[model samples]
Each structure stands twice: as structure tokens, then as C-alpha cells.
Target: MSDASTPEERLAALDLAVPEVATPVASYVPAVRSGDHVFTSGQLPMRYGELLLTGKVGAQVGLEEAQRCAQQCALNAIAAVRSVIGDLTRVRRVVKVVVFVASTPDFTGQPQVANGASELFGQAFGDAGVHARSAVGVPVLPLDAPVEVELVVEVD
Candidate 1:
């Protein structure tokens, strides 16, 4: 993709489609904007309202699979951001990202898995997608998803 391309076009160049905003699982909304920032709730690797994979990484799942799951989580997060702002081009910066990896007792590669989301942001937003991030290993996540991610972005 070229610098002239928009984020949406960059996504298509990667053969990734930004799905419709997922239905909220509970009481909270997908995202909310405050001041110049928009915060998105945790996004599971769900497509068409169903989880793509459900298991604990390093146990029922493997590292590579978990990485793909993380990518999907980021894709979903992007969709959430668009659902609020109408266009991803409105984003001037991706300020922060948090990823939760459901893992067994021995998994120590949460950062690599989380890079799945981070790298995609870099691809879609270039320097703008560079951001602070946290990758945490957890006992479980909602709906037994292998990975979950959330983001905070600065919009135009």
C-alpha cells in the first residue's frame, strides 16, 4: 500500500474487511468519545456475532493461532472505532492499546501475540498507529476467547 492510500484502503489491500460493529455482549457500548479521544471496549475475535476461536492460549490453543486471534481482535477494534466516528480516516493517532491473552500457567509470549494487533495498526495507520500498549495474560476472557483487545485513539 502507498502513503496515498487511506486506512480503509490499506485494510482492503491486506484482504481484511472491517466487519460491522459487533453487538454488545452486555450493558456497555462498543466505544465512546471524550474530548479528542475515543476509547473502545475490549473486542473479542468475533465474526458475525460468533467467536472465531475459543480457548486458552498455550493450552487448548497455540501461539500462532493466538496471534491470528489477536489480529482479528484489532480488526474488530477498528470497526468499533469506525462505528463511532463514521470513518477511520478521522483518526490522527492510535494512542494506546491493551490486549488480554487467555493463557495457561506457562505462557510467556503475551507480547508477541499482542504484536499481532500492534503491527496491523502500524500497517493501517503508519506512524500514526504507533502507540503505548499493554499485553496481559489472564486466566480467562469473556466467551472463552483466545484474545481480546481494546484501543484509545486521538481523532481529528
Candidate 2:
């Protein structure tokens, strides 16, 4: 996969398109490249400029819906990464992913929820996408989004 085609082509193969990087909701930029790494800011499950799901998982939101939301967050993060790096093909590997799920106090399926993002990365990058990850249950998220994801990638 080291010689894989441009990321836009890879995403097109999956019937996906990198979105225009969502406008930042606050003071932070969407991503930054430092040396050999690109760090994406936390990305909400927003599409077409709207939050797709909201509320705490295991409560107002169901596990399945939250999982899907996580996928959208991952896609948004990739868009953010691309905005900074200029091309997904520049990514050498996904180093780490951090997914935050807003949850009821009893919800313990954070890891499963996070797989939504992991699976997408796998589909897009194959072995290069496998990454160290953290799935955390949080009290709430900005815009009341059910999930958010951020990425740390090593780039050429």
C-alpha cells in the first residue's frame, strides 16, 4: 500500500468523497502539520454543515447510531488532515486515533463504537491504517454530538 494511489482515488473507490473541511466552530484550526506528523482537531459527526446525531449514547442515542456517527467523525477528520497536508497520499500511516463518545454513566461499549472509525480507516489504508487508539466515554461533546474523532498521522 506504500505505493497506493492518491487518497481521493482511494476514497472514490469506496464511493466516498472528502468534504470541504468543516468550518471550525471555535478558535482552533482543523489540522496542523508539525515536522513529519499531522494532527487533526477533534471532529464532530457533521455532514453538510450539520451535526448528524446528538446526545449521550446508551441514553438518547442508541449504540448503533453512535457507531455510525463515529464513522462520519473519522471521515471529517480525514478531510481536516487533507486540508493541512494537501493530499491523503502523503499520509504514511495512521499512528493513533482518539474517539470520544458521549455516554450515559453505565455505557461501556466505547471501544465497539470506536470501531466505526477504525473500520473506515482500514478500508481506506489497509495495513497502514491500523493504529493505536483510545475510546473514551465523555459526559458531553460540543454541539451535543454523540461522537467525535481526531487523528495523528505520520506523513511523507
Candidate 3:
């Protein structure tokens, strides 16, 4: 029940295998470090450059599945961070998370869906997980993913 683990220890304890970095489909980089902070581009629910699911949340994709997609986005963000810092422990704290959910016009549970990513961060970074976050409903996302997540983290 306790997601308490130092960043490095969490990687080892959870077998936090970092996935391959997702390629950028545009001019933006996956992540960028400035001073003690790293900001990542919005990561879609992708695996190997392919979207895992596409469509509007609460319609073709259920909230549960969208939650899973959000988790995957978190995983992708972690991978991006590791690509730069080489170690998860270098992360000091998750500063912010912006989760965008492609939603049906009437959907209003974006925050709960974004909790998927927020919870993952808590599990992976413990106290460092507390962060400013925004869960916004959008008309669409690139590649039509149900959810996309971007992170801002402070690192050593």
C-alpha cells in the first residue's frame, strides 16, 4: 500500500525497466533539462512509435482503459527522463504533470483519468510524487490517443 521508495531503489525494487525512448514525430524533443528541471513533451499512449489505442475517452475507450493509457504515458515520460539523467535517483521531485484527455463533448472526469499517471508517479517516487497537475479535456490528441501526459521534474 505504501509506494515509498527512493528513486533509485524504486527502479531496482519495481524492476523499473525503462522502455526505449519514444521517437518524436515533430520537431520537439522528448525531454529537455534546464538547470534543475526537466520538461517533457506530451507523450501519447504509444509503444514503439505506435499508438496503443485511439479514440475519445468515455466513448470508444472506457475510463479504465484511458487510465491505463495515462500510466503508459507516465512510463514513457520516465523513459525520457532516464535518457537524459541516466538514473532515476537523479530526479528530485516531480514538479508538474499536465494530462490531456481526448474526450466526448459531455465527458467531465478528466481529473480521475489523469490520476492514472499521478498515482504512478507516487508509486515510483514516493514523497517526490506530489506535484502541480492539470487534467484537461480536449477535443482531440495527436494520433488520436485517448490520453497524453507531459511532465516537469526537478533533478539533481
Candidate 4:
């Protein structure tokens, strides 16, 4: 468990900040709340309106860079969730996470890359952040981003 008192504090301890929610490139909203849960759309590894990394993992992008991209995507997902909930403390549990990695056909490190997002959540929310997850390798992602992430969280 994190020593920090709150999710924001834990993220700060990791040298990360919840970035502003990125404008959806399409017609879809960033996130929506239904009942006690919030579901976030796929979030790219964009920082300041630009993709943090491009190309497939095991090609132009490496494993570590892809992992960083996953972390950025998770950060964006958090921002999306907060946009709907207004308060991060309202989160009860991180229900699920889905990570997509653009990678070469032979590449097989998707799970390790997903750990970047998972670890960040664990640090930020402690036990509440532990959740089921899926890591998938894809031919490409929107904007050629190295990674993308989506989240589902139960809220108070």
C-alpha cells in the first residue's frame, strides 16, 4: 500500500500529475458514468496534445518506451474518470483495465508493458487499484500511438 494519504498525493510521489482530459478526436465522449461505475474511452499516450511515442513496440519503439506510453494512457484515463466524477476520492475500486500495444507480430511483451499502468494504479489507489486487466497486441492504434488504455472504476 502507498504511504501517501490520497491518490493525488501518491501520483505526486511518483512524479506524475493527472493531466487534463484530452479532447476526443471523434464524436465519442471521454468517459461516462452509469450507476456506480465510470467507464473511460480508450486513451492514447498523448501529452500536451501530442503522442508521447509512435510506431510499434519491438520496432521503432522499445519495451520501456511502450511501458511509459501505457502509463501516460492510464494517466489520461484517470483524467477522463475525474472529468465525470469530480472527485478522485469517490472511487471505490478500479474494476478493470484494458491495454492495447501496437507491436510487431513477433513481439510478446504486452503483459509487462501493461504492468506500467497497473503499477501506477496500485501506487495511486493502493488495494482499490488492483483490478482485472487485459493486454493485447495490435497492428496499430489511432495516431500510431505506441499504447492505449481504457478503464472501468466503481465509484461511491
Across 8-90, the per-residue lDDT of candidate 3 in tens digits comes to: 46655666545788998789999999999999999988887788899999899999999989988998998899888888878
Between candidates 1 and 3, the TM-score winner: 1
User: Would you list the clashing residue pairs of candidate 2?
Assistant: none
**Model 3 residue 96 distance off true place after TM-score fit, in angstroms:** 0.3
TM-score of every candidate:
0.97, 0.94, 0.91, 0.97
C-alpha root-mean-square deviation, candidate 3? 2.3
List ranges where model 4 is wrong by over 4 Å. Answer: 1-4
In model 1, the runs with Cα more than 4 Å from the true position are none
lDDT tens string, model 2, 41-147?
Answer: 99999999999978999999998899889988989999999898887878889999999999999999999999999998887777788999999999999999999
Clash count, one per candidate: 0, 0, 0, 0
Candidate 2 backbone overlaps, count: 0
* lDDT (C-alpha, whole model) for all candidates: 0.93, 0.90, 0.88, 0.93
Tell me which residue pairs clash in candidate 4: none
What's the TM for model 1?
0.97
Indicate which candidate wins on TM-score.
1
